[model samples]
Target chain A: MQAILQLLVSGVLLGGVYALGALGLNLIFGVAKVVNFAHGEFLMLGMFAAYWLMTLTGINPYLGAPIIGAAFFLVGLAFYAGLMRFTIYKPELTQVFATLGLSILLQNAALVAWSADYRTIQIMPAGWESIQVLGAYVPTNRLVAFLYAVAILLAVLVFLRSTFIGRAIEAVSQDLVAARLMGIDPDRVFLMTFGLGIAITGVAGGVLMPSFYAFPSVGSFFVLVAFVVVVLGGLGSIAGTILGGLLLGLVETGIGYVAPDLKEATHFVLLILLLAVRPHGLLGVKGAEKETLK
Target chain B: MIEIRDLHAGYGDTEVLQGIDLDVRAGEVVAIVGANGVGKTTLLRTIAGLIAPSRGSITAEGEAIGGLGAHRVVERGIVMVPEGRRLFPRMTVRRNLEIGAYAARARPRLKQSLEEVYALFPILREREDQLGGTLSGGQQQMCAIGRGLMALPSVLMLDEVSLGLAPIAVKRVYEAVRAIRDRGLTLIIVEQNVGQALKVADRAYVIQGGRVVLSGTGRELTNNEDVRRAYLGLTEHA
Candidate 1:
């Protein structure tokens, strides 16, 4: 029973990181209807940024998150303005290829610059790596990442509900034609959404640096995890994302406990089954998936 | 005041509005009536800057705005309540109304405009917290028009206000239109429901094949023999 409880706690903590990683991708996809194939690359860049911030300036990643977030916001703006603007109105294939090309470019660029070295940050001092909760041991870094993820997600929800610009973003996400009639420039909204999405990812990357490795190819792994979370959560639904991540985290941790080698296989198997059974996801609006990709 | 001279516009490769000309003065309820597929919608869409004019001049208060985008057109004081209510279905009524005032021009008067919209559609106020999609068709139309008003438009345009509604709901919308006109805002209404549109319009234009076939006061056109024969589907003096 203690074993099961420990697994559950670990799963929930892990799910928090997954949720944070997927949040930005979900936001970009929800508002802009762009699948953002390069999302993983952005995460990779974020990890590198956090790594360098710590290595060069000796600032803890958690403490340096604001700087990372602000920088990534600008990177996101440049990504949209310099590349996405041209292909935003094109066919879905065009967007897919465009972002895919960007992903490849970024991956290669990181490979050239940082090489294939795997790096990790030891932020917590000696003998303080794990914390006790409910008579179970949990890593301090994972717990901190989990708290940050939940807090940021809640903050995003509040902003969307309360602010004028946030409401405009929601309006555009719902109906572009209606939003235009209401005097919203969809282009501006798209630009802002891209920036905001990437900015969140940067923060997620920074927070996860202590627990995870900072390697160029690491983003590819997390991106797949993010896709699973997003697909399970429901496309374009923030609250659904949290649910999806938590569910996946628990399932993966349970699978890991039973058969460690088959752990990675569970994500694809579950994703395929979920897609077949509930393509709209756990809480996605019906037909939204079709509307966005098509 | 607005003027469209020799407007020519269409979707890619297919011309819809060809050589269309129109003039709408301030404080006039002008109805553009036509059969389905006769370019009535195309004209309004072009005027709203959703469709760029291929070869024409659209002057609003003497400033050319023919190829301006929809957002820019709204800044020029034109707001369109589209064919369908087109409300953000998931958003609350209050959010929908608030979004309508998103234009820079309307943001300053958001409080006043919101109060007026709520005053005009008291049902909207009562259901302010309800999602837009949950409203009945009649109530949706009222909410849509109310949203347009929230933009603080000098010239408000409504496309097919009576598209799908019961007779009582139609009457309610007409009464709202009367009240809006009484408030002294310029309006350009396009309708296939000739009777209701004519009842409320101060001036009327009969469009056929993207051309203005006739123009006169609402009462005059309502009684015109040609208008009766063509649009009203009435047989010439049997």
Candidate 2:
């Protein structure tokens, strides 16, 4: 019974981190209607950014997440203005290829800039590394990341519900042509969505850096986890991302308890099963995936 | 007041509108009636700046707004409630209406405009919390119109509003049209239902092959032989 409880606690914490990482991808997809293939690469850069900020400025990553978020927001805007603008309205294939190219470019850039060495930050003091809760041990790093995830999820929900620009993003996602008729410039909405989405993803990466290793190919692993979380949760759904993340986390952890070697394989396996069975996801509207790129 | 002269527009290499000329006075309810694919909707789209005019000019309140995009044209008070009642399907009815005030000019008057829209369509107020896609066709039309009104546009263009609605729904929609006309706002409507459109319009143009084949008061077009035969399905002898 204690073993089961331990797995559950670890799963929930890991799920929160996954939710944070995928929220940015979902937000960008929801509004911009483009699957940003470079999403994982952006997260990779975020981890590197966090590492450098701490190395150079002596400010810890937990303290520097907002700064990283703000800087990545500009990178997102430049990404939209410089590259995404041209392919946004084009065929879905064009967007897919464009982002895929960006992903490869960013990965190779990371490889050259930092090498393939795995890096992890040590922030927890000697005795405070893990905490016991209900007889289950929880890593302090995972707990902190989970709190950040919860806070951000609430913030995103409020932003969508109460703000003008957030509602405009929602408006554009539903109908691009109609949004235009409502006097919304699709370009401006796209730019803001990308910025905000990347900002969140950057924060998530910075928050997760302590618990996970930072490497060039780290994005590949995270990208799969994030995509599965998004697909399981619901396309374009913020709250659904949380649910999906938790479910995937529990499933992967439960499976890992039985076979540790196959834990990494669950993301791919579950994504395929979910796609074949319910592509619309738990909260997504039907046919949303089919129409986004067209 | 708005005017379009020798306007030509179409989707990439396929010209749908060919040198169309139109005039709409303030507080006038003008109907542009024609068959499907006859460029009636295209004309409204061009005037609303959804499409650029390949040739000719559009002037609204004496300002030349020939090639300005829809976002810019909206600041000048031209708004469109596109066909199919293109409400943000996932957004609540209230949120959809609020989005109508997205234009810079409409933002300041959001509260008053919301009141006006609610007063115009009480059902929208009732369905305020519901997602737009869940509404019935007639209700969606009302929601779409309410959203357009939220923009506080001087000239409101409705394209194919009566397309998929039932007869009673169409009548209710026209009643709202009458009320809007009485409120002294310019209305440019493109409706497939020729009989219903002509009854509500002050003046109308019968478009054919992208040009205004006939223009007259509502009653005159309703009585004209060509318009009667072509649009109303009536012959001189039948």
Candidate 3:
């Protein structure tokens, strides 16, 4: 029983990072209706940014999260202004192809600059401290990361609910034409939203560095997980992504204990099953199909 | 205050609006009536700047606004309530209204505009907390109109406000139209319900195959034999 409880705790902690990663992707997709193929690259770039900052300046990764986040936000804005603007109003195929091309370009660019060797931040304190809860040991870094995730999620939720610009994002997500008629420049909203989305990944990368390794292709692995979480959580629903992340974490962890080799297979199988059962996802709004299309 | 002369517009190769000419005077309510594929909605969309015109000029207050984007046209004080009552389904009624005031020019008077919109549709104020998607068709139409009014526009254009609504709901929408017109805003309405549109409009135009086949005072268009036979289905009675 203690073993089961330990697995559950660990799963929940991992789920927090997954949730954070999925949140930004879902927000950008929801509002802009563009599936950012380069989303994973942003995560990859963020982790590298934090890693380099810590190595060069000796700034703690945790303390440098906001700085990295701000830098990524600016980078995201430039990415949108430079490449995304031309294809935003075009056909869906154009958007998909353009972003996919960007993803390829970014991956190669990282390879040329940083090389393919895996690297992990070697913090002095080493973050492996654990706490005993209900006879289960939990890592302190995991706990801190979970708390950080929750805080960011809450802040994002409040931003969406309380601010004028946030409401415009929601509005554009629902109906682009209607939003435009309301005097929102969809281009400007898209640029800001894309920046905000990528910036969250930056913060998530900073939080994750102590617990995970960094590599040129590290983002590719987790980006798949994030996509799974986003779809399982119901495309554009923020709260749904959080729940989906948790559910996926638990499922993956539980299955890994039973059959470690089949853990990845189990995740994909469960995703397919859930989609077949509920096309719109568990918490998705009915008739919200339009949110998925541009 | 709005004029379109020799306008041509389309989606890709096929033209949806061809050589359309019309004028709407200040404080006048103009209605355009036509069949489903006759480009009634496209005409309104062109004027609202959703689709750029291929040729010709659209001038509001004697300034050319033919090819401006929808957001720019909105900044110029033209607003549209698109067909099918397009509301932000997941957003609360209040948020929808707040977004309606997104234009910089409308931001200063947002409070006054909100009050006016609430006055025009008191039910919106009552259901402000409800999700927009949950509203009934009639209520959604009301919300769409209310959202347009929130912009405090100089020219308000509504496309198919009466579509998919019951007769009583149609009456309520027309009443709102009359109230809007009474406020001295230039209004352009595209509707399939010929009788209801003519009842409130100052002038009417009949579009067919993307061309203005006929146009006159609302009463004159109502009495015209061709319009009556084609649009109003009055030939059977005649």
Model 1 iRMS:
0.6
lDDT of each: 0.91, 0.91, 0.86
The alpha-carbon deviation from the true structure for residue A216 of candidate 3, after best TM-score superposition, in angstroms, is 1.0
Tens digits of per-residue lDDT for model 2 on A87-194? Answer: 887888899999999999999989998999999888888999999999899999999999999999999899977888888888888888899899988899999999
Q: Model 1: what TM-score?
A: 0.98
Reference-based TM-score, model 2: 0.98
Candidate 1 on A183-217: residue-level lDDT in tens? Answer: 99888998889889999999999999999998888
DockQ, all models: 0.88, 0.88, 0.82
A262: Cα error in model 3, Å? 2.8
Tens digits of per-residue lDDT, candidate 3, B25-133, equal: 9889999998888999888888888889999999999999988999899999999999999999888887788789888889888889898899999999999999999
